[model samples]
Target: MNLEELREYCLSLPHVTEDMPFGEEILVFRICNRIFVLTNLERIPVSVSLKCDPERAIELREQYPDKIVAGYHLNKKHWNTVSLEGLPPTLIKEMIQHSYDQVLAKVPKKETLKFI
Candidate 1:
């Protein structure tokens, strides 16, 4: 999906907010103030850095060598960088959803109550 489509999907999730703490070039999607998805706004083909299970992250890197790789400047074991062009839109959306769920899981129940 394109940047706009990705942005729209992320915002559709519960208690999601958009931020540019990394300046105008990088857009961040957060849950309870913790980052889960990040995209570089100026990049031609959108690239998203998403949180993922450590093992799955490694597996994906091996499977999609050219399109998916270790997260740039992120904790590699817990994240992966996904290029929109190389993967199907449905798979990308699933990855985004997984990242959102992972972050939400880490958040305290009291804080996430508002999302419900």
Candidate 2:
């Protein structure tokens, strides 16, 4: 998917909001104000960094060594930067959802109910 497609997908998630806190060129998607997705707007092919389960993150990098890697400028153990140039769109959506769920899991139960 491209940058606009990625932005649309992230905004489609409940409680997700976009911001340019790092600057206009860096786009950030947050759930409950906690970032789950981030990307550089100026970059082509749309690489996105998403929060991920540690074990799954390593497995993904291993399985798609060229298309996926440890998150750039993010905690290597808990995030991944995925290149969208040739990866399956379904997989991209799943990774985005997983990142949303990871952050949602940390929300307080009462606050989380609003998203349910």
Candidate 3:
């Protein structure tokens, strides 16, 4: 997916909000003010940094060496930077969903209801 598609998909998730807290060029998608997805608006070919399961993160990087990598400036054990240009949209959406789920896992159950 491209930047627009990525933006729309992230927004489509429940309680997701778009922000530019890091500045105008970096787009962030958060649930309950906790970030799940982020991207650089100025980057070519579009890419995203996503929260991910540590083991799954390693598997993904191994499976797609060039397209998926350790999250830039993020905790390498729990995040990944994925290039959107060549990957399947379904996989991209899954990663976003996983990130959203990761955020939900950390939220209080009652507070998370706002998303449902």
Q: Looking at model 3, report the run of 10 residues with the lowest lDDT sum.
A: 107-116
- Model 1 lDDT tens row, 37-103: 9999898788999999998899889999999999989999999999998689899999999999888
Model 2 misplacement above 4 A: 110-116
What's the lDDT for candidate 2?
Answer: 0.93
Could you tell me how far off, in angstroms, the CA of residue 48 lies in candidate 2 after the best superposition?
0.4
* Estimated TM-score for each candidate: 0.94, 0.93, 0.95
- Predictions ranked by lDDT, top down? 3, 2, 1
Cα lDDT computed for each candidate against the true fold:
0.92, 0.93, 0.94
| Residue-wise C-alpha lDDT for candidate 3, range 1-116, written one tens digit per residue | 88889988999998888989999999999998899999999988788999999999999999999999999999999999999999999999999999999987999988877766
Cα lDDT, model 1, residue 87: 89
Instruction: For candidate 1, give the lDDT.
Output: 0.92
Candidate 1 accuracy as TM-score: 0.94
- Candidate RMSDs in Å, in order, are 1.2, 1.5, 1.2
Best by lDDT: 3
Sorted by TM-score (best first), the order is 3, 1, 2
